[model samples]
Target: MFGIGTYPRGGRLFVAALAVACCGFGNTGTADADTFIPLPGGIITRELADGTTITIRIDEESAKVSPSLGSTPVHRNVWVSGVGSVDLAGPSADTATIKISPGYVVGCQMDISSLGVNENAGESNTLSQTAPYITPSLSESFGGGITLAPGQAVARLMLDLEKPDDYGMESHKRYNKVPGPHASVTWVDEAFEVNGCGGYAQARSFVLAEIDTTTFIGNLALWGQPFTMG
Candidate 1:
């Protein structure tokens, strides 16, 4: 469920609030129960070099965690949904373009909180915080299940753009671009599976944006609250 669209100013991206649910599953449970976790999405505002103000928001985030159909201690399954949006205001607002890339960081017995950018950091500092955890260059296809060991982590992008290159060969991109003063990307029920982690595991969502004002270029990112995958 990937879509790019224009959202009107001051409009809400998601109409309804998610109800929190309580359910648990593990290696021994019925394997049919699902736990729903509602996440507190985040927002960031940055003033670019040329006095262009860019705001990035991650909203309507939630995840459904379930025992792996494999019914093994090392397998886990999850369905995630969220919306990523960007709004530009200031000198170059009318002619700006935005590229939105939404993804997740999954860790096996590792603390992923530190891998995210500092929300309080300045524009230059935030742009410099491109650790592999935040900007993963992995070649693996995200929808395909991933395998991880303890103390290891991986980043999986939710958007995969397939297009033809200049040579007519197939190419893929992790981000979606749209002309904008305001643009958004929505994803629903995107599923990913994890395997080979016998210990505790966790996942967090993030939205990264590259903004081109036709004069100034900048980057913005927002991170969601991390949740356990049982």
Candidate 2:
């Protein structure tokens, strides 16, 4: 993975900027500080096994990091937003279904910079590779907040769509599904909290997309730059 406006076939790119806010209540250092990171989202173009071309783009993504309202060393807060888009070309493009899953990977005292679209970040075991492609697990959830210890990491999805199931029971989904040659999912100012980490913490954004067409099914992922939580 790379950073910011870089497109290297199957690689990733991200760019970030940080702004520090003035402290209040006589607090010093990074305590009570707020940081705004502007991220340059990425784009990926891939050709499926049946000669279908798919493009996925992560755009208008950013995060605002600040001290948690608890004001404790073990608590952190962030607000994130992004847009995930998909476009398809070639055969079966008109009848394809796209599923978009946008989420964040939070690590406690561990460097998650090496986590790529093809590798599972120590959280799930369902990631499998099919020659030049990977199938990502889509069973992540956002259960209020995250708690992590040193050397531990978690993947929290940003969306939870509540709808009626086949039997009229409530069903929750972590991804948005759409049809055809183009689709998009947009999230704005979604806030999440992390706690129980006594060391430095970091988080990165990702968009996992699955394209199901008449001829073949494929998966694509785009990643953002990692930013500090404290």
- lDDT for each candidate structure: 0.66, 0.62
lDDT of 2 by residue, 185-216 (tens): 77788888888998888877777766654444
| Local lDDT at 128 for model 2 | 24
TM-score of every model?
A: 0.78, 0.75
Q: RMSDs, each prediction?
A: 7.8, 10.3
Which portions of model 2 show Cα errors greater than 4 Å? 1-32, 49-51, 118-141
What ranges in model 1 sit over 4 Å off?
7-32, 117-141
Among the numbered candidates, top lDDT falls to 1
Evaluate residue 2 in candidate 2 and report its C-alpha lDDT on the 0 to 100 scale. Answer: 15
**Cα lDDT of model 2 overall?**
0.62
Clashing pairs in 2: 3-14, 4-13, 4-14
What count of clashes does model 2 give? 3
